[model samples]
Target chain A: MALRFALMIDPLAADQTAPDLATTFTAVDPAAPALTVGELSTQRGDGIFESIGVVGGHPQEVEAHLERLVHSARLCDLPEPNVAQWRAAVAIAASECGEGEGVVKLILSRGVEHGPTPTAWATAATAADFSLARTEGIRVVTLDRGYAIDAPARAPWLLLGAKTLSYAVNMAALREAHRRDADDAVFLSSDGFVLEAPTASLILQRGDTFITPAPNGAILHGTTQLSLFEHLAARGFETAYETIPVDELRRADAAWLVSSVRLAAPIRQLDGADLTVDAEFTASLNDYLLSPRD
Target chain B: MALRFALMIDPLAADQTAPDLATTFTAVDPAAPALTVGELSTQRGDGIFESIGVVGGHPQEVEAHLERLVHSARLCDLPEPNVAQWRAAVAIAASECGEGEGVVKLILSRGVEHGPTPTAWATAATAADFSLARTEGIRVVTLDRGYAIDAPARAPWLLLGAKTLSYAVNMAALREAHRRDADDAVFLSSDGFVLEAPTASLILQRGDTFITPAPNGAILHGTTQLSLFEHLAARGFETAYETIPVDELRRADAAWLVSSVRLAAPIRQLDGADLTVDAEFTASLNDYLLSPRD
Candidate 1:
């Protein structure tokens, strides 16, 4: 599929009348490059971003994504992004990719190294297939995130809770999992606390209760997980947030990795060891996650 | 000064006659943009980079920077960069800057998300002045890097030694330091061992011995520090690599932050506490650091 892109050099100044900023162009090519080599986003990964799932041309959990984007920008000390501009951009991109499931990304960066303006853009592209993993479950490996559970509290400079573009280490952890013949990875703190996954949140079943790690500044609060917990609470399921030990993962009745695009993928095996999985529960949880909502 | 940039889509295939790839472009304007929104470098920070100082249009310590670039790529599992192509590009950029001190950066990224090739570029711009810091010295604050000293050794997936473009945390640390009324920062491990500065190497004077933190996989092996150690050793100054405790920094006679561009800037104070600095000694060290070398 040909990827569609739109660039707003100064997204803050974007108004309804600006065609390139308001309307998604199919083939309306324009002059001037979208980015320069000196952009902080290119040179230093100094930016905040969000990837929203588009199902049948409708964005899923956009308000949560936007809230997280603002929180991330605050962590990086970047200027506040114009949420109306972002909403408009997302609408254009989603409309352009009509009737199909796609990925819409909102990127707000600290512009050029020497320039004061921030660079923002929206992109629409075909989503990758996670159908097999979502149905058949996935195998995972445990990797160390090289931090103690309290690391973030002591060191805010780490930007642990922010969804920034400096994801090289996260990508490396995923590649290491792939090399070890696993489909995904769950990170463990150096002090033996179970952290979140590289790009997802961890959820496990303990008896009839659904438990996930607390948002202790070491992990990005999972938007999908929040939605799932609300749905589960409405259906008479007990939900809790606490620090989980790595060993407890093996003892859980069932485990899953939850995210924006993939929803909830059950864990069939971890570190080459088989784990319990309830397929019926997995399907029901995915149903609740993917169901239409504002 | 207007920054000069040259893009090489596939630098590995660069040859003498490929003007756009081998020879730096002056004004060969293109209709299409150089970077797309889907670039991994912009989106995920999946790239490696090097900044070399050019004096009188000659790139300083090119060999050391290139060696580090290769080492960084290996850590990231990125495709090997073509050194010959990089050399040609750097030469052209430095030449274009013409007879003045400048900064030339070599950036190699994982290309666009949909493309298989890597994107490489060389940018030349006037260097920022460090004359004040070099002469009057700088005050520094110590911040925790939120990692144990042994974290990197046990977790290679952290990409600790690789100088990747995912530098958001580094940039944040600098900003934090600036907010605290300091000019720079020195990061300490969670276990209380001094690691390195946000963008430079930490060198402390313990009597006559020059002590620096060993490359324990948690810090980038600094090129400027290595050159300074060699220069000091030749001049009958003792040097050693060992893990320096944070307390030692407070009691040290002198300290300096060393980097390729900034060279050597003496530390006037640490965490608002004054320290001894011999101006004559600092000037001599700067002279040795900037002296002609291959």
Candidate 2:
């Protein structure tokens, strides 16, 4: 229960008297709460975040997560985050977690209402074990995402590419999946293109090629998925980025949901029909995904 | 700057020792902040909210706002809010604002990440003046909302009709409008059907009929629009709800963005082209809208 939390407020703001990262991180109490109601993130969900896995006090894919967070901030029109501040905060949080394994959340918000600058924070907590999901795989159902594949190009205001904090709909989709006695959900575009899972990126294999939906401004640029593709390419495995049809999932030889925390979880069932899952291949992908990148 | 704020935690939660309405209301410091970091609202945008106009310490259209809140809660799968508690809190917050007009925001969130019950609060601040928007009117640009008009029926996970706190996209749309030198935005569905504005409902007059986009599950139910329709009916004006095309807006007699606080602000221009305005009719409608409903 000894979770680590640290907040970094705008130093230039006259009313903010909180200590800087060095002292604050060192003195953070495990039981103390770290947010205020006036924050734009809490009030309007106007922010961006990254959830990086922490192993043995080191953040996994720190650079990749930071790059994605910055990209997300740009999409939301947020001020550029202080990368050094985020790095320091994450290191402190991860170290304080003193870990076998944990989850480090990097949150950069649009600051308080009408206040100048942004609010940044890092929190470290025990990571949820996904051993069963990795080995036994997951059952998923398809749900309409209510938008066409070209939505991102047609509407930038949609903020489709950003990994924003406005994830209520995503969470609701997962809840709906659970309500239907399923483990997860695969969202399909209104025009019948496979999009992604509620919390993870979709990966499907037809033969030797590991395929995923192209970024196309419709999906978040998945760091974990990108890392896996790089590893697969180096090992002479074919990979692709394309507009995947929902029917392609049914015809797929294997499918998986890939993310930072869960790594690669194969699809055991699509809808109610059992799909052929390559357990050995899935185990190999997890090994590549979980391995620390230089 | 003396704004009134109060927090309400579930009484059944043993850890929450905060006093109920009476003592908490009397002791509230206007300057004190009312939220903490653990709240799911700030973290995940998992909540619903209502903003009611308080005129001379009396909340306008209380029943309508509360009823809408209930509907929104049902959509988000949140527990039934304690209506009596909300009423008491609103009364206290309103009373604390003296005889001046103010804005009262009622927020009900999914509570803390690990906590059991929901978190609810009401905050009252001086109302923002919209005299210019009311008299001079506003210029609007149409933006694609990235979903088809019938999307809500096909996808409940979209939370289309619910006024949840996950309004980053809405806020972004407004910002995009401002960037284009427009005062507001009227969101169009991907299929080019007129929907509604980010924060307000659209009402346009065609011939003798007051036509607004029907609540086809793609837009939030507008309390102000509903109240106006009732008042219009009483005054012998014809009203109708139907699927509105963007082209129809160009041919309309007059259009307005109606909301609780702003009341009714006429649209003077659509995408830079000046539109006809019935100032006399708009003023008359505002009179009806501002009048207390039984």
Report clashes for each candidate as comma-separated counts. Answer: 0, 2
In model 1 chain B, the worst 10-residue window by lDDT is B23-32
Q: Clashes in model 1: which pairs? A: none
- Candidate 2: the clashing residue pairs are A35-B37, A42-B42
Off by over 4 Å in 2: A1-3, A9-33, B1-3, B9-33
lDDT value, candidate 1, whole model: 0.83
**Cα-based RMSD of candidate 1:** 2.9
Tell me the tens digit of each residue's lDDT in model 1 across A103-150: 788888888766656877777766777778888999999999999999
Error of 1 at B26 (Å): 9.2
| Model 2 lDDT per residue over A1-294, tens place | 224564553423322233454553333333454454556787788788898877677778888898898899899998776666666667777776565667788777887665545776667777777889999999999999999999999899999999888888998999999998899999999999999998899999988899999999999988889888998899898999999999988999989999888889999999999988788888998877666663
> Each candidate's fnat, in order?
0.67, 0.59
lDDT for residue B149 in candidate 2, whole number 0-100? 90
Q: Residue-wise lDDT of candidate 1 within B137-206, one digit each (tens)? A: 9999999999999999899999999999999999999999999999999999999999999899999998
